[model samples]
Target: MGRSKLDVGEIYMAESKIDARIYSEEEYLALDSDLDVKYEYFDGRVIAMAGAARKHVSITGQAVTALNNQLRDTPCEAGSSDLRVQLEGTRNYLYPDVVVWCEESRWADKADNTLLTPLVLIEVLSASTGHRDGSYKLEIYKQISGLMDYLIVSQNRVYIE
Candidate 1:
């Protein structure tokens, strides 16, 4: 299957106005090989992810570092944005800012890139994505069976929820 092209203008437009093209799980996964950018799959809709700001990147790194430092010598492990987390039995796939999983980690497929079990999911909010991150993504992240906490960190200020 070939990867679908997305219009940058459409992606930055208002949520309701953005043109959404649905793709099957197979087609979505195939995009990994073709696209330079990362996307999040929600149900059958592929949402384009914007590049993180400098503050967003810094906060995410600090969060991951703090979590890893505290989790050292334990079963829990912290991962960065490159880790793709699947929403259990659903077709949804998201790349969180930081993810922490304890005990054995589960992979969605033989490739071992998609993580099925995440204990904690964190998102460092940006101006463009803060609203969706705090609301839409929060709701979806809550569906994970083993998810204990979902955090939304603001890059503009010292806020976390």
Candidate 2:
């Protein structure tokens, strides 16, 4: 399949749905590994992620920093957006802005890039992602047995849910 790469700092307004072709979990993972941009797998479709604005990046960084400080000397560790989280028992994989896990970390495979259990998942909302982050992704994330908190933070203002 033909694909276009977004340049750095280019803002993709919405989830770019891949062509009608359905991809298996393995296929998605294999394709994702070779790409520069990140994509989230939903069922059999892949949704291309949007570029983060300055505020989004700042909020995500601050959240991770704060979590790291509070989790120091503890069992928990914080992860940035580069971490891929797999929703167990499903083919879905998402990249939350920040993830914190208190338990022994679990990876989907030897690759170690895909995290299996995260206690806290944080999403720094942007204008393009606020709706999907709050609704569609929320329902899917709820299936994680070890998830204790799901935070939605607004980059436009001081708000969190």
Candidate 3:
């Protein structure tokens, strides 16, 4: 789909063009630390986050809960999508739906909200970010040396990768 031209002071619409402001890694982190909404940074551009549907929220909970139950006996721990994972290679700040780690869980900063060493990452797809999630994010996540699995969960039906 072609992107529509963005107007100044206009509300953001999914799939439509916006300010497209590019942010440095440090600047993005500052925003992430204080901002209520999570913005994904890639190649210097900030992607505005969209709200998830109720069904999407439910599926995400189920996926995380199941992963936690399965890993209860092991040292590996499961975290919901709230955790921010920085791609070790590209340095893009990303939030996965479920992050499971058996390795060291280090703090990203003094704030300690971000998890830097997640071994297994899961993403619950939404309509607006499906393309980027499947293509852009998938390629970056695959490069993480410690990441064992990258699961892409579809909200429309029972599907995962």
Candidate 4:
């Protein structure tokens, strides 16, 4: 069978309005291939997450470095924002700011990275995405049995959850 079509829904946030969209994973990937910003796909719905600010990138960098150092002598490997973790029985994929996975051989170890089971996942939050990171994404990430921890780092302060 073929994939479903994309549709727009009326989304209201107080005085602000946004268009909620639903598209198949394949359709989203086809669109994402040409876009610059990373997006998250959940059950045929697409949400374009905000890009990391300078401070957000810095914190993510440091976190990835620390995780990499910690796994230097082990089979686990650490990664940053360019990597994606497929979740929900491979129905969805998200590009977390940082990820650590034990299955190194399966990963290509490149910039556009992929991990089967990330023991740890980190997200540097922006103003537009802080709430989703804390609630929606948190709940979904927890569903992965291999995910041990999901860390959320604030862009404005030295806060890490």
lDDT of 2 by residue, 1-161 (tens): 32222320022223454545678988899877855888888776777776788878888898999999999999888988888999888878899999998658788889788889899999988877776788667877788887899999987677899
Model 2, position 59, has a per-residue lDDT of 84
- lDDT per model vs. reference: 0.78, 0.79, 0.70, 0.68
Q: Point out where model 4 deviates above 4 Å.
A: 1-21, 104-114
Off by over 4 Å in 3: 1-18
Backbone clashes, each candidate: 0, 0, 0, 0
3 against 4, candidate with superior lDDT: 3
Residue-level lDDT tens digits of model 4 in 1-161:
32221211112121122226668777877765655776666666566666667887888889989888888989887787777777635556677888888853344235435455679989888876676577656766777766789999888877888
* TM-scores for every candidate against the unseen true structure: 0.85, 0.86, 0.80, 0.76
Better of 2 and 3 by TM-score: 2
**By TM-score, highest first, what's the ranking?**
2, 1, 3, 4
Error of 2 at 67 (Å): 0.3
Task: Give the candidate order by descending lDDT.
Answer: 2, 1, 3, 4
Task: Give the Å error, residue 69, model 1.
Answer: 0.7
User: In terms of TM-score, which candidate is strongest?
Assistant: 2
Model 2 C-alpha RMSD to native = 7.6
